[model samples]
Target: MYSRSNNGARSHRWTATLVMGQVLLWSCAAEAEKLPHNLQIHGFASQSWLMSSDNNVFGKSSSGSGSFDFRELGLNASMRPLPRLQFSAQMLSRWAGKGSEGNIRLDYGFIDYTVFSGETSQFGIRLGRMKNPLGFYNDTRDVPFTRPSILLPQSIYFDRTRKLALAADGVHLYGERRSEMGDISFQAGVARPLVRGDEAEAAVFGQLVQGHLAPEMSYIGRVNYELDGGRIRFAASATQLNMSYSPGEGSIHFVPVIFSAQYNAERWSLTSEYAFRNLQYKNFGAMPDMDISGESYYFQGVYRLTPEWEAIARYDVLYMDSNDRQGRKWAASGTGDGRHAHNRFAKDITVGLRWNITPEFMLRAEYHHVNGTGWLSTLDNPNPADMSQRWDLFSILGSFRF
Candidate 1:
């Protein structure tokens, strides 16, 4: 009887040990499955060579060797500590001639909290530095893979004034609604615009001033609609960016509204955007009280030759003053110099090709026939007297991502 009882006890102990081992194995599997949902990381790097016939672009491109001055590097990470909360941040270093100078800066750092989430709808808020949803590519403009060409359409995405439109410091609210017919989404924010860069100074004041420009409260918002899971998309965005100068002077304000649309298919895509900008200056003595409206627009098309090859074409135009499309009125009025009239508008025709060697690597080449110097960098072309009315630009770029 004792032997039988001892054997039965040993069997029960073995059963308990097997069950505990199974539980431990299942727990490890479950943890492994949840790893992907908890954290993620992404990054990209790119280098470009540029050459121009007459004008300088992305460094001294007119030289025989061209310019190897255009480079971009960025890294970003995101983590979800809870089902309804997330944290994200990115750092960027860009070397685009004198304008960017390859300074390492925080591109975006934000905390996102979802207040309500459902199968078909969701609402959330973000706090900290956030990318401004200005046009189709503004939010992800720095990422080379996201762009159709080596350079974005300058008419709407002017590199000269990129700092002001890149991102702002403050709060953003967003919402999304989905359905079988379509999906609609919106993002609105109240933030302080970045106004302390040389590029911003040149864009706003026409030149770098002795006194620095300071940021003030500003507002920005965008609404978007997508059909058939983004086969067709449309968006409208607007911003009221405000700023003031020191020494008890006056103020400057910029209000821009943008409309964007795109259509995508298996082999080709078409994209277009239009922007109207209103600028006003007040109370600054000796400086004329200026109120002007500018116009810009572009049409672009991309064709996919194969899974790895693509071609692109775009026509972009910008007018510093809608009323003075030819710049004659401003020239006659003598704003500063009559020769500066050529600085008031630009029209560009571009064609480019892209090759995706792999999912993580790409090479691209492009050419631009541009008329007028309206969007030329003031830092690179400090003296407008030397600029040519018409010029050509060629560029090659290689990019990698992970």
Candidate 2:
């Protein structure tokens, strides 16, 4: 006795009610799936304003107030789905203020499989995304709250970036050999190369600006020996770079030699790392500016005066064949013939004090004096021309992290 329209309306209402019920059920199940330890999350809220008499060396302008800006929000979580298998993930979100939507980037996320082989040799394969192991420092390189200095030596690694050697999606093989002197471990992996068309173009001028780990072809291997007394690392790396400008016409060879030594105890710790790299451009123009071979190193001494306070003094240096066909990062910020042979060199001295205000919080203040022509700013400006302007720099910085 019901009309067709009435029948259709009733059917539609039933479908809608069913869909709502399904959504409510899913919401409840999702809430039930979370656990205290399985869903762990932690982050830091920080504020920093650059107080400089001048602008940045890169020619970029700074916000007028020195205005307080949020540096990072970190979230770390891990789960053990099985007795021998575990997964971990970390995210670092940066808020530079203004209209910046902020970047929710994957700091690290991978699955680790433990091998009962008894030597602390865990066979793990990472699928989602992983960090590159070009050198020792690239592993634990992070920002203010964790590092003793405001800036990581640019010669090695820089801050949170989408490119220029960072988290890449691939598989990693890491294992350590145990011995009486200590445990000697090795990490090696093969993946896409670190340089593409633009990356290649930038490297020609000696400014490895950004973008590493693309689908080109790269290999990294590292060996480390750690004992209760100390630790040492020996790393060897090779990368095959392919860029768009050159097409399949040319390639790059990178041979990096790395070394690290660390001694940690109850009150004090000393850590150091050195790297020597040889970069060759193949099938390119016959120019000195096109070929590059360079070396860089850093040494740090830490004194944990107490649980509440720590102090550190560090020095780092880089030596590049300044006279290559074109200039390098130490060269003035500009376009290059890709030619130069000036024996480019840059070195800086830094002294810092860290206050462990509490278990979850820390503060840092440091001073730096650098002598070099390239992007050398003792201050926190990204522009090279703003600070150095073809001269050396004396800069200071202060930042806090949680």
Candidate 3:
């Protein structure tokens, strides 16, 4: 049967990823020994198997055995040529359904110059391609060890718009101040977001259009406060991300603001984030000028069962149109079929377990009960009609880092 063949293929892919991951890890270890003390090399690899009861996630998860289409590989190096100057770069390959097909690409490459350094305070400038400081997790979202969960809360960190949020090309200024009271850190940047991809085009135009999406000038910044060495953390971030559709077409503009807070303890942690998004479309003749506001938020809790084991639970929500939370208004407006109303919003409940087998190896499993397909990748699910409003997903992942 076709289902059997598909399942077999997925199994093979999963096995292949595991073998590749081991090879890469060994390779990194070998190279690390040859590198100089000033030059440090590190990398991580993760592969995930996902299955859904009703909808697709990270590939054809709705099918018999789920999909083995989720994986991440990263290699990074940092060198300090001088005490005040450092160079860092990372190359990443990510496979997450049809939106990201595991292409090797530059994640970030930057030169950092420290203008001032004190016992408790420092200021620096970074030039070149740098990660956007959006929230607590954006800077290191791709690394399994750095993430609190297998997936960062999708409401605030939607994979659908990942390229735009991942990193930007330009200059950033950063400062840090630490005292007995707490620590304050900030990073502000002027850059151009990445906007060339099927997912990016679909997100901006509601569908892939005839023309291509081009990056334009954008600004991003984040400020954070930590108390008692991260016992408590809070942050505020904002972005003005802009892009233009070339070949004599319209333009797209996005402005989003986010607020984040977290509490950490020896045994447990609590975290929350909220975001407000504004979007506009213009100049495309038949596309009609439009303006929309969206909202997203999530609350999560993590408990450490042991030094090497942890459990996590979270609730995340996203709305395409703040005014139409239920999506009935949009359904009635007839822009599309009424059945697709579920696309306007999504509510997700997730729970997961993580086990650190070793300092460099980890295994994780998670489940998600979701209502709505608001964040589904258009490239993965080209036919919205076949999508189910409610779905159940289960996933397992193995990760290694050196």
C-alpha TM-scores of all predictions? 0.90, 0.70, 0.93
| TM-score-better candidate, 2 vs 3 | 3
Residue 392 of candidate 1: its Cα lDDT? 96
Q: Which portions of model 3 miss their true places by more than 4 Å?
A: 1-26, 31-34, 337-339
Tens digits of per-residue lDDT, candidate 1, 291-368, equal 999999999999999999999999999999999987878878887464667789999999999999999899999999
Task: List runs of model 2 lying over 4 Å from the truth.
Answer: 1-39, 52-70, 95-101, 115-120, 134-136, 158-162, 193-214, 229-250, 283-289, 322-344, 373-402
Error of 2 at 222 (Å): 1.2
- Identify the candidate with maximal TM-score: 3
| Model 2, C-alpha of 131: deviation from truth (Å) | 1.3
Inter-residue clash pairs, candidate 1 = none
For model 3, give the RMSD to the true fold: 4.2
**Which wins on TM-score, candidate 1 or candidate 3?**
3
Worst 10 residues of 3 by lDDT: 1-10
Q: lDDT per residue, candidate 3, 302-382, as tens digits? A: 999999999999999999899998677887888755448888899999999999999999999999999998888766776
Clashes of each: 0, 36, 0
**C-alpha lDDT of candidate 2 relative to the true structure:** 0.52
Ranking by lDDT: 1, 3, 2
